[model samples]
Target: MGGPSENPELWAFLESLHLGETLSGTITAIERFGVFVALDDGPNHPVFPGVGFISIPELSWRRFEAASDVVQVGQRVSCEFLQLDTWNLEARLSLRATQPDPFQAFADRNAVGQKLRGHVTKLVPFGVFVQVANGIEGLIHLQELTWTPLKAPSDVVQVGDEVTVVVTQIDRELRRLVLSRRQASPDHL
Candidate 1:
């Protein structure tokens, strides 16, 4: 209904590739959910050029405002094979896996207990999320929003507030960086 449907020869080709193998393709379409890739060396699907497909998180290592920021429809990309979406018969791929992670760039230059300034990106019931680095965020827990006890996170910080926070912990495995505004700010109350 969309691009093309599965055929016998195409099915045989798809069966030949193994997971984690590197493949080349052209970005044929970009949807809100992900980018569809037309493989240079692979067969086409009946519905899409999805011999390869890259999800939003798998598009790039940097924080991009949108998909167009990273690639265009005709752009070529070399991606690692993630898996085959059997239900849809699309090739699941990762573009970022081909390059270095920008989060590592932030980690390399920063450490725990260090004071850094960032803008509050979001305020939730649990904490304030701050963009300390491009695509990297640190959480200032509700209790850490101020030295004194607060009723809610909003009582201390609002969205888009430029705040200084101290790095409390960095969990690389989970890609989490914890921050404390209370530790960085002197108690005036």
Candidate 2:
């Protein structure tokens, strides 16, 4: 099939929208992969259901179980224009852009070696997710969970267990926060 370049009208419409600009639209469809939006000002998409598209990751800044948890069909929403999705024949949009990034806010106020207390949110083979702040979860790798040896994170901590952790690394660009429980211990020094 042809791309947006072949459809001059859609191409012009998509190009008219600058990145980070706010666009209003109605949620036309929600799929496992992304959400579709019928832009209030753009032409109808020649292929898809809508001229605007929001990927699953762009739907929210916080973790969610599903797209429906953050938005529903027919919901009027404002999104930040991310780019022209020529491959998908739609304008890529971001709902998360319209909201403050909790991770960024968390990073700005905290630094490495800082101690934080939060409950365990999840356990995995390699690490545990701890919510150090609202909508912000830091990963404590199995090696960092404690100085002791363990076969799994569950061996030491379970979901909802409150624990003190020290921020080990903050990768702002990647939006990752690494934590260490072993260092948080008073005797670690």
lDDT top scorer: 2
Runs of candidate 2 exceeding 4 Å displacement: 1-8, 186-189
- 43-153 in candidate 1: lDDT tens per residue? 766777666889998998766788989999999899999886766767789999988776777888889999999999988988889998778888888888887888788
Return the TM-score for each candidate structure: 0.83, 0.91
lDDT of model 2 at residue 96? 94
Give stretches of model 1 more than 4 Å off.
Answer: 1-6, 62-69
TM-score for candidate 1, please give it. 0.83
- Compute the lDDT for candidate 2: 0.91
Give the lDDT of residue 170 in candidate 2: 97
